[model samples]
Target chain A: MNRHTDTPAGTELLDLPMPEPRTCPFGPAPVYDRLRAEAPVTRVACPTGLTAWLVSRYADVRDVLGDAERFSSRPGQVVHLMAHADPERPIGEGEFTRMDGPEYQRFRRHMGPEISSPRRLAKLRPLVRAVVDERIGALAAAGPPADLYQDFAIPVTTASIGGLVGVPYADRDLFHTAASGVFSDVTDQVQLAAAVRPLQGYLFELVRRRRVEPEDDALSRMVARAPSAEPPFSDVELVAMSAVMLVAGFDSTATALAHGVLALLNDPGQWARLRDDPSLVPGTVEEMVRLFGGGAGIVREATVDTEIGGRPVAKGDYVILAIQSANHDPEAFPDPGRLDVARDTEGHLGFGHGTHQCFGQQTARLELTVALEALVRRVPSLRLAAPLADVPFKTGTSVVGPERVPVTWDEILPAEGEGP
Target chain B: MRVRADTALCVSTGSCALTAPEVFDLGEDDGVVVVLVESPPDEQRETVGRAVRACPAGVLSLAP
Candidate 1:
């Protein structure tokens, strides 16, 4: 009994794969351009063998992601790759990501201040900068032809996020190993369970520890603040919150950093421009995010029969908001295919929209800015060691990035003030 | 242009601040949008407009 055949009457189904593998690393599957041109909101066969309404246009995608009332983020309600395979439990259970209305608001209210506060994130900048510098220093010592994705982006992102979340440096590898699988393309029930179990156990223990002896990190602050909320969070809920934060923090930023490097490396002129002017780092980061930010798309379930881009959507129908397509929509952005660091990326859906917009976006931006500035300043001659087409890209993952960005440079520049 | 933010609707994604740092910021206590410039000079109007449009939550609006 294939779920694809179970679509309600009056809905049209088109055979289109979700998370459509990219032929070009910088853009989404070419099919999205066709969809945006013709059927902006049409039923399509998801990769999981279920049928979902794939929303492609910029305005339509925003409308779906933004209207939590009309569209629900609850697990089974919004079917994605993994959720389609396993609908018994909510994805990111107890995490605000799956919650709606007051329940979501409650959890977000408690967790928001700890991670998203400008003051808290501002204080993290120097520490983040130090991490970037230390990582770059190691890369310099290792010489050129290093995988920036693995050696540089992964470590800096994991360490900075781990530090904030109170994940012990000793347990960092174990934490990352377990957390990384949570976003993998794996959809088998047993395989998914196996991937998530260790992470769940680790976070449960960490939450218990934070409860007893709190630290200055985000986890401790969340624990301390949880009890004061209108409807206090349970231990299990807090554990889930930590798990969500850890995965979200590490995976998205790591991908962005790695992909940002790949984007810059692809355009030597842009790379040179950035190297010449460090002030462009912030705008460059935004541009990279707009151009290269990857996710299958935002998923939402129709809570009530609604109209998306003037197309009727029935209640309980799954809607996949193709964010990458929307970000690259020619309507919203002129010459959307081109990467312009100086382009005003205002209103890009990279961080998403509405109440569900990424709360930690500022933190991600800060990390990217500091890291890119440091890389260009330290190694202005850095270029891809391998041909761009030869580089492997990660598939079957919610967020996409280079498997390894093998980059090389001419001469290793000495640390500032060090004798030659 | 007079700029006002509907604090009730603000999600504090900080897009406005990132778009126009001189005109907007997030509150220290609640992390909601804070309007730093009520009336912007001509020089800052375009950036402020971008900031208003960049706001995901539709909290920012301009009045003549």
Candidate 2:
């Protein structure tokens, strides 16, 4: 399982850290800027103590993430921190993210429609809105000086995803705890395995139940669609797919929502603009997605010798797409540092690019839009309770977000219809 | 303007629908890009162009 042992002889590995920690919440590591200008694709040391090429420019990052044939998503191909300590597993087995070629397509085809179909997402909008309203209501009733991350963001995201996945309301805490551990930055192989086992077992049992008596939810739909596949999906495959979706959907969206709120509060002008025009919520959410740091951990491996940003990449070479750097690239985004709610953030790599792009992006957008809109409209005077520098930020993880966003607001505005 | 989508290459990221909903919609059954307006009006040409550029899969294109 030691991927570094497979490193070709005579290749010089740079001692740069993977996902260089941010000194500022809004900006990427300063080294990323230098890399984009100097070496868009250059070797860097991974947290696993291995080396991989980091692609920094927007176009080059897209090139690497977009070409599936030339670049493979197979698990063993990438340099994960825990890979050496864990046993070698099959490439296309656990999750579609780890699979390439037909195997990846098969699973994605079955799961994609359930999550991305416009008709289905349209139906889920109200459910998502309701989740937002309920969470905001709880926040409003509980009074000021609350942890928005815990009080609102986590609940709204977890409930929305949980409902879609058919996890019962009462089981959300259990689901959240187990799913969070799986996505956390725990480097110990045994600890990582311990975190993943509970989730795998939970999903297996859930899928088993759905198979017997299907419910009106995403997992049930997946269970019903399983038999229609060419060879039919096995229980193990179903569980793996479900686990991946849960971890991917919950962790990323929750992180984005929390960070989005923090960004708005930090820039009062943007918050005021959003509150003044609720119609701008969707656009603001898009801008927030562009500005945030969600895709810092995306990795791909070259299956064939290729050139990116004019740098040669050998087969089996691991490449990390510096998504935040790409998103902030001045050529792609004007005034890349400023939070402009009106900017046309058309091609930002927040959800990433190419075949492996996020399937749940539309749903994630809907959740962020609804949640942010509801929060602003309900509490017009909401502001951060603590200094921005004092806020705890989660680091050393694929996803970056505030661990706690303590905020307070002037009087809780009376519920609509209970007007003055 | 004539618009077409390479369904084979589409990954259903929905960037087209997000950018130009009038011209493209995600297929209900397969989750691939569905071209709603093959020949879009002149007014929609700009939006279609944006959608084409926004597509992560590079599946959509306009007639030259």
Candidate 3:
């Protein structure tokens, strides 16, 4: 049957096409581009046998995200063919991303104290900076003609996630392998689950350890609050939350840093401005977040059939909230194609909008700021080692970033008076 | 006239503090949100708004 065809009232539902991969490595998706231009909200078939309303306009996407009552995050609402296969199991209890209402709030509460307050984030800044410096130092020492993604991005991400999860640095290789398996797209559902289960097991063990001996990290604090009295999360919940934090914390920053560096090298004006004034690092980081557009959309499922943007969405429809696309909508951002570090980007949806916005944003910001600052300061002459298009990008997944970004720069030695 | 933050809603992403440090400041201890200036200088309006828009939370606002 021809899918996705009806308005909220009676207008014929236009079959919206997908857009080119604006941020993905797999070239452009014209279906979405057509929809964005012609039908702000249109219906389309998902990979699964269901149809969904695609909200492309900036304002509409924001409206949907802000009004969670209309849109629910429950896993059962829409079948995430990729998330789970059995339909019976459907992921796990710690899948907080799929939670709504009081459940979401409670899970968020557990995480709130960990990342929300600036003081907690400040404690993380030094560690993040050290990771950034270590990665950059390794890259610099390796000399030019190095893929920044491998030498810098991977190491920093590994270190940052390990530090946050209170894992020893020595254990990072195991965690990194587990992470790759969980997030890998090449693998089938069972394989992916196999990868995730082990990591989940590790996190549960970590939570159990923290319960007995509270440490100075997020895990301990979470366990200390769990004390088997309050709205307590089980051992599984704690571990799942930690795993989520680790994955979300590490992947997003690494992707953004890898892409952000490439974007800066391509645009010399921004690089010069940032190089000249190190103070702009933080603001520049925000602008970069807006521009990278990784994991371009957040999928939301309608709890009941509802009218959205004048389109009739069936109950359990997959509503793709195109955060990255909206951020670049012409109406919200004039000439959205341009990347201006100093632009007034107060409305961009990079970290998302409303209650479900990223909890680790503050930490993400600190990490990116430090990484960028160190990069520009240490490597003034940094440039692409190969043609921009030739750079390989991460493939077949929601999160978009360069898999290998080769960079070259003229070597500059410290002044003779500087300590070696 | 752009780049205003609601003290109650501000989660301290530091977009404002980073965009216009002259106008925004964070608590030293917990980094709870605070305003160094209710109104930023005219010259910084656009950049400040950029800061506001960059906020992950909708805590920042702007004036036309």
Predicted structure with the largest DockQ when compared to the true one: 2
Q: Of the pair 1 and 3, which is ahead by DockQ?
A: 1
**Highest lDDT model number:** 1
What digit string (tens of lDDT, one per residue) describes model 3 on residues B25-50?
A: 55532334566677778887777776
The segments of candidate 1 whose C-alpha lies over 4 angstroms from its true place after superposition are A1-12, A18-22, A76-78, A83-93, A414-420, B1-5, B17-30, B34-48
Query: CAPRI band of model 3?
Result: incorrect
Fnat of candidate 2, please? 0.53
Q: What is the lDDT of residue A295 in candidate 3?
A: 46
Assess each prediction's global lDDT (C-alpha) against the native.
0.77, 0.75, 0.68
Q: Would you give the TM-score of chain B in model 1?
A: 0.94
Off by over 4 Å in 2: A1-13, A17-22, A76-88, A92-94, A414-420
What DockQ do you compute for every candidate structure? 0.43, 0.57, 0.18
TM-score (all chains, Cα) for each model: 0.90, 0.91, 0.81
Docking class of predicted structure 2: medium
TM per candidate, chain B:
0.94, 0.92, 0.73
Q: Which residues of candidate 3, in runs, are more than 4 Å off? A: A1-33, A48-50, A76-91, A412-420, B1-64
**What tens-digit string does per-residue lDDT give for candidate 3 at A1-420?**
232323345444544333343344322243545567888786555544445576878889888887667787654322422443222345467777777665666666566656655556668878887777666667667778898887887778778767876887786655666567655535566776776776777777888888888898888887777754246778878887788777666776888888888887877898898889878888778777776653446667676778777767776566777666677677888866666777776666788776577767777887788788877777778888987778777664556778888889896434223455
Candidates in order, interface RMSD in Å: 2.5, 2.0, 5.1
Across all candidates, the chain A TM-score values are: 0.93, 0.92, 0.88
Candidate 2 local Cα displacement, residue A147, angstroms:
0.6
